[model samples]
Target: MTNKKRLELTWIGKDKRPKLEPRILLEDVARSYHAKHLVTDNDIFDNRLIFGDNLLALKALEQEFSGKVKCVYIDPPFNTQQAFEHYDDGLEHSIWLGLIRDRIDIIRNLISEDGTLFVHIDDNELGYLIVLLDEIFGRQNRITVVSFKQGAATGHKAINPGVVSTSNFIVLYAKNKTLWKPNRVFTARNKRDTRYGQFIDNFDAPYAQWRFITLTQAFARSLNLPIRGLKKAVGDSYEALLSDFVVANAPRVVRLARPDYDAVSGDARSMIDASHKTSEILRLEREEFSDMFFVAGERILFYSDKLKLIDGKYVAGEPLTTIWDDLLSNNIHNEGGIEFPKGKKPEALIKRCFELATIDGDLVLDSFAGSGTTGAVAHKMGRRWIMVELGEHCHTHIIPRLQKVIDGEDKGGVTEATGWKGGGGFRYYRIAPSLLDKDKWGNWVISKEYNAAQLTEALCKLEGFTYAPSDTLYWQQGHSTERDFIYITTQTLGADQLHALSEDVGTERSLLVLCSAFRGNPERFTNLTVKRIPSTVLSKCEWRHDDYSLILQNLPMAQREEETLKKKKSAHPSLFDNQDA
Candidate 1:
């Protein structure tokens, strides 16, 4: 045996990856508002609307959401070498690849073992993205590439040198091939097509045909059974066998045989096996065995076991194929009340993704939540969701759109189809300030903007623990495990305080205390461990002053110029610029 060879995509800067900060989310209650029409009986405050660089947002979500999100649908900037009103769509090829690679790495970590990712893209980067996804999600894990018709061919086709683009693609991949289970999607049959019955009908209305065993020589001899409606023919040949049935004009019965079994012994077994094998070979040449059935003086037909009779009609449906053109891709501009004419995806498209990959209450994430389409669709479908965006549209477009969804005032883009008379709400969060910064003496210290609660949560995330404080135990801030707890404080700890903390922890439990300073014996307690803040966490992550627009600004100068032009034309010069300020 030989080792299997693998293929990978390589770019100029493929090896260089960004060192992202593991920041914390801070819910700004003043900016977070809910609709009055929202139902008061349910808990709808858990949905998250994060405003920050998606890379940092994804990193912040790592501790709480790793291997927990059931589905992730991202429509990143397509790098189409054009400027959009809300986003700068042009980028240097290498920079765009690196930016996507970093975010995709984190997305892979965020998805559950059985979860899947649906990445929407156009032809400009589909080939490159496929190789990139194969590297991250593995080649065998790819589910399928679905082609969606965006619109009719444009009139500019005559002037263009290439094919007129009328379709976009959504590529899907599973985190783990063995654990992923995609659900089937059923579409109603067109009334005109139903009348024709060109395909197999389901008792339900639409269905795909499946294979069934038909009469053959192997089936006839294995059970020594005779056809019920037809008399025995003189010869054992297929022509003679069918002649009896053709003359009778009645429903025929035949025995079904197990192809792999042996019933005869010695010479008789060899003779029967050879004869049956030849008959089977001849049967393989017939087309009706796989898909069709022939009836006297009638056209061929096909059906599976699922075929059913309802209301005097046979109804059937086919399995959904990779090519999807039935759903409406346009006319979704009024969805969420955000009229993003340039690149807004239809809610029906995202709805299909959710239907195929997730169930109700499962966590869904969208890093590039342009116009918040993914979030709105996920919300109406009863799934929990988190959306992150760095642009002002996070406020102007997404917030208002989601507000309308909650108030039941939005009546477009799958709202009526899903019967969404809105009820739930979402919490708005900003990425927390950096935890550590250099002081006047060039020594690292905790940022002054952090309050006590913010400090504890940031430290907990840095120390690899969940931030869940105990009500009775003030010192217990978080925990890595049931017995291993972590505590954070700015106060200095002396010998007595150390002894008391150790005693409180007891012999069975242990605590890691993080403070500004400590004065205790070197070998005093086995249940306690002390470490200084700022110094310990400084090395854990790359601390930076700005958390917003870092990923977008890091692109090449040409891309920055395009963004500047986009901002200037929109009369929003400060939109992408000075976001951190």
Candidate 2:
């Protein structure tokens, strides 16, 4: 057997991972919005809209949201080599890959075992993105690359010099392909199928007594038109009139085709053979399927079977394909009462993603939420969603757009299709300022931006505990489990204070205490493990680091850090070599 491995798309800083600060999220209740009352029983009001760097925002969400999100859709700013109003669309290729790689790593963690991810990009970095995602999501888990035709190459676009680029690509991957449940989505057609032109005049009659006639003659009779003068009477409207009639009388009008005898069941084959042998019009009834009718060794297929309910109308439909050209972004500039111009994705496009990957009340996440299209569409479709945006427009654009969606004032973009009467809400949050900051003395300290409660919550996250403070118990600021608890305070603790906390915790439970400073031999208090706050967490992460990025300039710094780690391991060999010991 040949040993094989996935090929990686390597670039600068691919190995150097960030010691990310899992900062806490602080809600801005004033910016949050909801309807006065519920529009429906299933309305969701707990969606999140985070206004901060998306990478950091995703980190803030992981502790609580990991393995929970059902679908993630990111329309990330790519290397377009052109600047837009709300985005820096161009970045160095290596840096872009690094940026995407960091976010993708966290995104995979957020995706549940049965969840999926979809990313929209053009051809420029499509090859690299595909390889990167394949390596991360596993080659076998990749679903498909959809060629989304956003616009037509007509009018001004047709006059362009080279092949006009009216379409980009959406790359899809599942967290675990085996566990994913794909909803069979279909594409709808506006008109009826012409093949179902034969009508059964005696459909209600018993077998061997049925009569057949042309559907056109039946339709003419229904319209009280003379069979010979049908074309002349309808004139230019003949096709439209006939199409409406066929759709209305779809069950009676059908096209007969020979069934594959080898593929059909024995009972159906018997009926088919009987119909051919005599003047018998045979029929077979199936509980899960429509009754099958045989006529001269052929199966009658009804036009109604091809119809699908699309946008409140039943029209002909086919299984959706990878090449999607129906979702057009035309005249949607004023949609959502704001404009991000080049960055705004079509609501229909996001709706398609949700329909494929989610059901009602599923959680959806979009980190690169330009114009909040994902949230807007998810709301209409009744899926709970969280959107993160680093741009100033998170307030200027997203909040206002969502308010309109909840208020029922926005009447465009999927509202009609989903029949949205609008009643859901979202809270506004910003990634709290990095936990630690430099002071006047040039020492790392907890920032003044954090109150006592905020600092306790932040330290809970850093210490790998859920931030669930108990109202009755002061020491139970958070907990990893019911038996394990943590307490945080800005005040220094003495032997007496430690004794009080230990007694409250009791021998049945354990508490990890974090404070400004602690005195005495804390090991004596069997259940308490006291440690200094800023000192204990100092070496755990890069303090005062508010932003995370992988840039070309940092390559040498990464090298130096790698060398330092290697030297430390060499000095203490057992620390690196023996894991179980």
Candidate 3:
């Protein structure tokens, strides 16, 4: 279906906005809800993760958090035939598309102007997914498809199976391509003797034989440098030279090389005199080594242009890339042994993401939040993070792993890999109920725990208001610019209350007094936008009726040229899933 049609199906007219109801029991609905924490008053720039169907969570977030996210990385299910076990995957093709598209549309709204979204998928639906993303994020915002190696080797199959295995594609889309900058992975210069030392003979001729040999030998001997380098060349002769120099420099040795030689003569005495400049020789070697040798570290330490040292702090260097192969993924895999089903993402990958996306104190978010990788990395890197998970494994697997990170218990891998000192902690939270049910007249009657005030607060949340008072008193709407003094009171509003509210509102701003019953004709008050209670507040909520999912499911077949065109229009057209629906 066209994007225009999708928008037409989802858009709600302003006049169709729902009214409040008095009999509706919004309390019971609120009570059934549960949450470990609420970020209601906290600063949002700090990281946050909302746990629920990404669709509902996105909608819930849209009102207050539009255009706020910086970078979003989602490793969504590839929709391959492989069993996910938990999620429903057997739905019609159009249903899956509709589901994914709905969430993508919402996700597009949440990205900040400079933000980018990375969608991970396999070859199966990559093309279809790209087209869908283009439709939502705009063709102009599309970025590169980064190929990530998934497997090391391909198992033997009948037809020429000697190739390296598969790779997953990361389809990146930016809110605005002009404002997006892809993070770069750090690169190291080849320092291995096998790879680079062979090029040593390629040095300039003037510096290769005499200058190189004499300077290198003298410096190496004075510094007591490893003899291994010189062992290959002038072996016995080089040691004899070192013995001569050591004895000549020794305090007790006198007339060792030449006796009866004038101190100022242009003979071997002059050579011995110049050779006594030991500090100068050592200085030249130290300078050369510092310029040539490179050490592999988490942060790239390179030669700086500045020669002066101010307070021993080195000036900042250019930022590094995110592609980190320094720590071998195989080493981590061998140690961990893939005991957990979801398994742990490499600490190097996690650290790389953290270094690119945030700084010390910035918040990182991971909604998939398996095993608390984001939280653990963020804590070690001195960044804050919020993680969300929807399985029992959160407590059993994720929490314990994160605890190890905080207490510095699991020290070997991440610490050695990223040079991270483990510290910091986080409070966990679950999404809670936002509304209650109703009886008949939509009356705001308390059934169990929540009262009329609590129901009103829930209504405010449902209506996209960020703040709700517990007293059910008149307070200006916190989020909306047009509306002020939104109230949710079941008690009948008397003339006294209205007059008092009017007095409090004064002539400065218009008042939106919402109550179960107004004592007088609301039309008579020209300034008040009074709303009566016991009306449908969630009139815009509706089940998706479109067949977009079927289209998505059958995309692979449709894209294949060999497929029969006759099946193009069928509801479940894919040849892969041709069995009974």
List, residue by residue over 10-126, the lDDT tens digit for candidate 2.
Answer: 988688877888999999999989898989888899999998888889989999999999999998877877767877666677778888999999999999999999999999999
Q: Between candidates 1 and 2, which one is better according to lDDT?
A: 2
TM-score of 1: 0.74
For model 1, how does the per-residue alpha-carbon lDDT over 355-444 read when each residue is reduced to its tens digit?
Answer: 889987899999999899998888788888999999899998999988888888888887877778878889999998788888999888
lDDT of 3 by residue, 277-371 (tens): 43221111233444212111111111232122221222212334322234444445432222344244556556655545445565445555555
For lDDT, candidate 2 versus 3, the one ahead is 2
**Count of backbone clashes, every candidate in sequence:** 12, 0, 36
Model 3 spans with C-alpha error above 4 angstroms: 1-50, 85-93, 154-164, 182-184, 189-339, 342-344, 434-454, 468-479, 534-536, 542-581
Decreasing lDDT order of the candidates? 2, 1, 3
Better of 1 and 3 by TM-score: 1
The weakest ten consecutive residues by lDDT in model 2 span 549-558
The models' CA-based lDDT, in order, is 0.75, 0.88, 0.49
Best by lDDT: 2
Give per-residue lDDT, candidate 3, residue 334: 30
lDDT of 2: 0.88
Off by over 4 Å in 1: 1-5, 35-44, 188-191, 194-318, 545-554, 557-581
